[model samples]
Target: MSDNLEDLKNNHQDFSKGSLDSNEEKNPYVLFGRWFDEAIASGELEVNACVISTVSVDLQPSARIVYLKEMVDNSFVFYTNYSSQKGKEIAINPKASMLFFWPKNERQVRIEGEVVKLPEAISDAYFESRPLQSKLGAWASHQSDELVDSSEIHNRMAYYSDKFGDVVPRPAHWGGYALMPQCIEFWQGRPSRLHDRIVFTSFEGTWKIHRKNP
Candidate 1:
């Protein structure tokens, strides 16, 4: 590879000028919602897309982009097939991280937490809320598994289409996951390179707040 390519690959995105003042009176959850609302108002694409990072039993790491569907009570929720790579990773190691960035607002949020499966009732409720086509696709796709041809998927969909023309039942393996945050960090970008970072952490029954250098 060229030296310029290597240098570019190693470069980091500099964020300057943002300040974090935890004096907002509201909790981190509320603050997050406020920022998210602003992001939506700013017309950012895929405001709900977040980077989910998981670790395997062998200590390897993997990550992917997934939609953030709900913020229930105090946790964030999303759904997927329980048999996928991420699913297996969480099965063995429940520690995970989620990152959200809104370029238009020059804001970023990072969450590190423990992963826990939502109650069956919650999962079932979200599953039932999905569109019939999504439900059918869920039943048709094997998720992270390999497929020999596109025909297999189409065939499966056809079979499901004939089997249930109007409505499709949610699969037991496809459901929702709740990520309970142990630490949450909010970042805002500034003019030069000095950015603001505020982090909130939970311990026992109390919460602690801190500021970190950019």
Candidate 2:
């Protein structure tokens, strides 16, 4: 009751955490690794959490938060049910974008490119390593589908729990997708709204670096 909307609107914090120079590493993956490590060192929570935006076949854009599982061969990897909304969207249009923001460090990274399903072996390995309950949940939840009642999930979960016992196999519908970025832009917030934006775009087999207006 004591909070004032006017006071909140007037408050602003100028970013000065860090800067990205033009002479930095040319490989976006290497640069991402460095920033990721720095974020971890700075004690940022859930550093791998990122927003993935996918456009439906009808041109409707949807965004959701997903955890970055790994980076392999310069591709960002994450896992989910292939029957989900995002999965269906990707099937229709392989083009997608991912956004990572570390508010504590005043930094954000935006990547755009084509997404492809990862190898089944890799997905199986990661799936096997997950906790038992998660494996059961994966089997129980029919992602992005309508449920008649809330208890349906719990009922399916209990059923799968008893059926699997131990050593649950990864469902064929569940797997990982890798986003191979064509352009990656790193943004470092600066004072007075003059932020720094550096982008790396792929051309042929090489990457071209460029600076963009804030």
Candidate 3:
């Protein structure tokens, strides 16, 4: 193992004690929102970042960091290139997992669920709200493709810049995916490596909350 890997393996972090009250159990979405609010208030770097994991048809898993754009109606929403590898993977198999870890709060949340394409109107509205540079870059770059040179990317940017000018339209190959979580597991740190784990699993129109072994 590398020196850094050895060092990381030997290192340990003790979690603070925090309990999720049982009475506060209506929706897991609300609990996640509350935890997200705390993470935001703690001022962690890129607090909105989440690790999205997707599996291909062959069951190979891939993960990438993506910024969480919104959580609406119990679904986590993030946008990316619909033609990217992840997009293609989801196209073939629409199941995905998401992880949110807040080092400062010693909290981690894992979610597993099915992915669904958002409405085109939702994508268009979000696309129009983006900064012009981002819009142009989105149109210019082909995600998950091999690039020969930086100059090619620059030329593509220039080409798109000239083609679309100021008002760049959202490409059909780019939009959002909403993960409808079937299970959400919340972890809180405690002393001596012992931790609190609470999981909510969705059933027929209801969620069953249970405590998990730490």
Point to the candidate with the largest TM-score.
2
On residues 7-122, what C-alpha lDDT tens digit does candidate 3 reach at each position?
99678777774766556666788888899999988887898899999998888999999988977577999999999999999999999999999988889999999999999999
Cα miss at 35, model 2 (Å)?
0.4
| Least accurate 10 contiguous residues by lDDT in model 3 | 17-26
Taking the tens digit of each residue's C-alpha lDDT, what string does model 1 give over 25-61? 3378878998899999989999999999999888998
For model 1, the superposed segments whose C-alpha errors exceed 4 Å read 1-18
Distance from true position, residue 84, model 2, in Å?
A: 0.6
| C-alpha lDDT of all candidate models, in order | 0.88, 0.94, 0.89
How many Å off is the CA of 136 in candidate 2?
A: 0.7
Q: TM-score-based ranking, best first?
A: 2, 3, 1
Clashes of each: 4, 0, 1
The candidate 2 region of ten consecutive residues with least summed lDDT is: 1-10
Residue range 1-214, candidate 2, lDDT tens digits: 5467657877898999888886788888889998898889899999999999999988999999999998878899999999999999999999999999988889999999999999999999999999999999999999999988999999999999899999799999999999999999999999898999999999999999999999
TM-score of 1: 0.90
- TM-score winner between candidates 1 and 2: 2
At residue 55, candidate 3 shows an lDDT of 92
lDDT score, candidate 1, position 20: 62
